[model samples]
Target: MAVRPDPIPAAQAAGTSLEEELAAVAASSLDQLRPRFRALFRVPVPDCLSRDMVARLIVHRLQEQRLGKLDRSLAEQVDRLGRGQESRRRFKAGTVLVREHDGVMHEVMVVPDGFLWNGGTFASLSIIAKRITGTSWNGPRFFGLRPVLKKHAPEAAVVVDDADA
Candidate 1:
């Protein structure tokens, strides 16, 4: 005669731990670099860099130079320490990128958060992948950015099937 526990709310259960981890990392990094950052730049410290920005930087760098073992090691460190959503989608406009730990969307825009573009253009999964591993992609583009994923065109020549039309 034991009662079953209620299921946790979707929002509560999703990515809360990740948000906390990111907050902790940001706080710790800021604490450690506050003095150096302050001395190095006149601008105020940023609250966070968007995952896209970080990815772009890393991917672009990797493409230009041979990272070898050192980059791989640093990437491993970041992969272990970093916390972020597994996916992202661009909308027509005004999409909320990061939601708060309490489940409210933060008011910050993605561009200021380090996303390279707006206009709600979808990003490629490969670009996102490179970012996570901290390796640069060797592409003609500056940041190793690619177009949004889409269905590949059929290789065979078109066959007319006009039943519906």
Candidate 2:
């Protein structure tokens, strides 16, 4: 976790490199190494980062945030709940839902049960699955794994309309 900040010219101007240190960081999963990484890098997170490598970093951080480290099932459920809320907020209706190259028209409805029911009759639940978990599986596999949603969910639901009010 010790980030030798670009070592002094005398220390390594010849050989030792940041990538080598990153290799050590990579030895432990991101969750196990992020604190060290953060401290060493002195970078504020929650900002745009490059792909895959950053994804691993994020996944690791997420793993660390879960209360029960050994409880994989509970951790997954928590992740789903958190991602669901993020997705709802990020893709609230009128917000474009873009996937790679395709576009899915948005028609979202926040039901009384805290379920975000895709509004259009032909809406694909897969969108919810992919958006929430980065995977697209059939059926309620996504819903079943999600945390038990409450009746009045989305404590910070940003309503784009006033009709409900």
Compared with the true structure, what per-residue lDDT tens digits does model 1 show for residues 1-165? 975433222212455553443343344433443332333344544668553443343334333433234567556666766764232223323333331212322222233233332233224423532443356532212222234243642122112222233
Worst 10 residues of 1 by lDDT: 153-162
lDDT of 1: 0.35
Task: Give the distance in Å from residue 113's predicted Cα in candidate 2 to where it truly belongs.
Answer: 0.3
Local accuracy of candidate 2 as per-residue lDDT tens digits, 46-163: 4455434754664454345432255776666678788764322322343222222133333334343333544333255456656644655542323332343556421221235423
Clashes of each: 2, 1
**Pairs of residues clashing in candidate 2:** 31-60
User: What is the lDDT for 138 in model 2?
Assistant: 41
- lDDT at position 110, candidate 1: 30
